[model samples]
Target: MTAVAAGTALLLTGCGLGGAPATAPVDTGGKVEGTITFQTMQLSPTFDDYLNATIDAFEAKYPGTTVKWTDIPSNAAARKVSADAIAGTLPDVMDLDTGTLAPLGRKGLTVDMATAAGDVKDSYVATAWQSFAFGGTGAAALPWYLNTPVLISNKAVLGKAGLGSSPDPTGYDELLTRSAQIAKATGVAGFQPTETGFANSLLTVGVPLVDETATKAVVNTPEAVAFVTKLAELYRSGGIPKDSVSAKERSEIETFSEGKTAYLESGGSRLKIIKENSPAVFGSVAVGKPLGDAAKRTWVVAHGLAVPTKSGNLPTAVAFAKFLTSAENQLALAKVSSVFPSTTASLNDPFFAVGDGDLTAAARRIAATGLRDGRTTVKPPAADAEYGATLWSAVQPAILGDVAPAQALGDAEAKLTKILQERQK
Candidate 1:
């Protein structure tokens, strides 16, 4: 537990384990009053501002109780959550991206929400609701905000490469090849993102088809491995540069704005960041759906609220979680955060109505914003939770030429097997 800011009951923390729960009831004992801490994601200042505004509103709505928060950097939130739990206390609630929630749920750290949300549950989308189930066990989190990777390219670079229009959104392989030529000729970086298993992941984003339910390791399957291998080839051929590793997703937009890179894996949210940095380039940059290759899939990641088993204040905690996600707060969040909103309505709201400018055009053209299907599914692939570390670790070395893809994955396969066995115990 963290220190409550003098007098105000606010200190951030995290906790839990999981299991299947049939249903539960909402507590209506007036209002439970106590200090509750929330974990925030290290998105941008926009998310921070939105959190502050929501906390203020929740406090005003519920007297005698208060909310406090601690912002966790994206890279560190997972580690912090795990470490905090081992210490025997957790923030009453927290924000987490998709990849981190599963392992925690396996350890029984999160409260299942199916029963917790009750009658009002119908309000959320089916796909979003399904994300709460962990390894087919308990409900772990809620859908809050989502961002999709879009195909962002430089008009001048593309035009020079004979690609028509600004975004064109016509070809992925062609773009990769053309970008390589451009980089070789102009020395401008072709892509700001280095491929890990990401190129393969991008393929799925372009055409999403992963069957985690099979209890098989598909990442090493021909389709996925080949898709990823092609990306590795591109990286080796100077089609994608090493500097891409240093490019923060946020900075990738900046690199494009400054005309340093020709192609990028960015999204609708980057529009605000790009516009802020250079309005001229922002208008010129192309925004469209990721060009389909052999398949069609789109990728999205969301961060939202969750409560800990260890929190002493469940009533206040749930209230704050509910209040924070209510339409009012969600819209408030969309305005400040500038990322894609999670609510069906917030996403449909005219971007100008929510703030200023048009998001609908882009949303429709690219279908760039959508809830993650993997999150709320009633069932998930058995080893899905333990796959990340192995999958990525296996893929990374091969992508960097430290090991052959097959060999690296072999090592990872062993570790993956170990992790699963350990978790069972």
Candidate 2:
């Protein structure tokens, strides 16, 4: 999940095992009066005033209702949520990403937002709304904030490598070609394919992670083999870093900041870090659309509000969630933070359509446009870390030249098939 304020990238660890069976849908009863505990992840101190004011407005709008707000540190949030869920003490309204909410929805710990508040379905972006649907359950959360990746390149590095200051590659193949040119000319890696564990790399290149039924893995196709083979070749030619094949997002950013790599693909909020840490590289930065297949789709990270089915006041909890994600409230939050709003009306605000000609502003504008076609990339059933790790572990050996790409993908397919079967059973 991406942090709303800092755009800090966090890995989606796999879900927990063993939970009580599904419960009946939450009954709101049309009375929005009661006290409900609301929990958010790492939005304090900086966003305290905005959140408090929002809460105050919510309280004033619906008299006799109170919101008790609590903020959890990002590092401890998942652990705390898991513990609370096991204890049946989850907050009535909680902040979560689809990655975190899906598992809970599978266990019926979360309210089906579509059933509880389906009338507002058309208010959100179709893709953002659908992201929360999982395990045959309707939408499990109300979409809040969102972000998408943009390609940030250091023009100085590109110019030094004879690629000119404004090098633009339309897709992955051209990106690889440019990467090789930069490495050959400047002896610096041109790109660092940050190990996402997820099959984002494959997805960008038009490879599907699974079949339509999602009961079988289909990533062992010829296109997948060809892409893996290219990655192996890039690694052998010093066009990409050795450690990068297993490195995290922080390492990728560090390499680009230090001028060891020419391009960094990340959220627009990350430009703040680059400007703070490496003004020299930041000065020469150019923003571009994310490189991908014909769909031109980019990866989106969304944060949403989920109401636990066991909430003491389902009606009030659900009402608060709706109020918090309202177009007006979401746009207000977007004005004060780096995150984008998940609501369709919020996105249409004039703020997203303009840029100030600065790199960061340009990135925001580009990212906003990207979000129109944006998606979470990997959908449920295969969205968990275990599934991603299975793909990565099988393909890593191929990237390291320890096995042929086809053979590695075959192994991955078999493993994924078995895992999916087990999950279905």
Top candidate on TM-score is: 2
Per-residue lDDT value at 42 in model 1: 70
State the lDDT at 409 in candidate 2: 95
- Which portions of model 2 miss their true places by more than 4 Å? 1-20, 165-167, 210-218, 246-250, 373-390, 414-425
RMSD of 2: 3.8
lDDT of each: 0.55, 0.77
* Model 2 lDDT-worst window of ten: 4-13
Q: Total backbone clashes of model 1?
A: 23
TM-score (C-alpha, index-matched) for candidate 1: 0.71
- Model 2 per-residue lDDT at 1: 34
- For model 1, the superposed segments whose C-alpha errors exceed 4 Å read 1-35, 42-49, 69-76, 125-127, 170-217, 232-238, 242-261, 269-284, 291-296, 352-425
Which residue pairs show collisions in model 2?
none
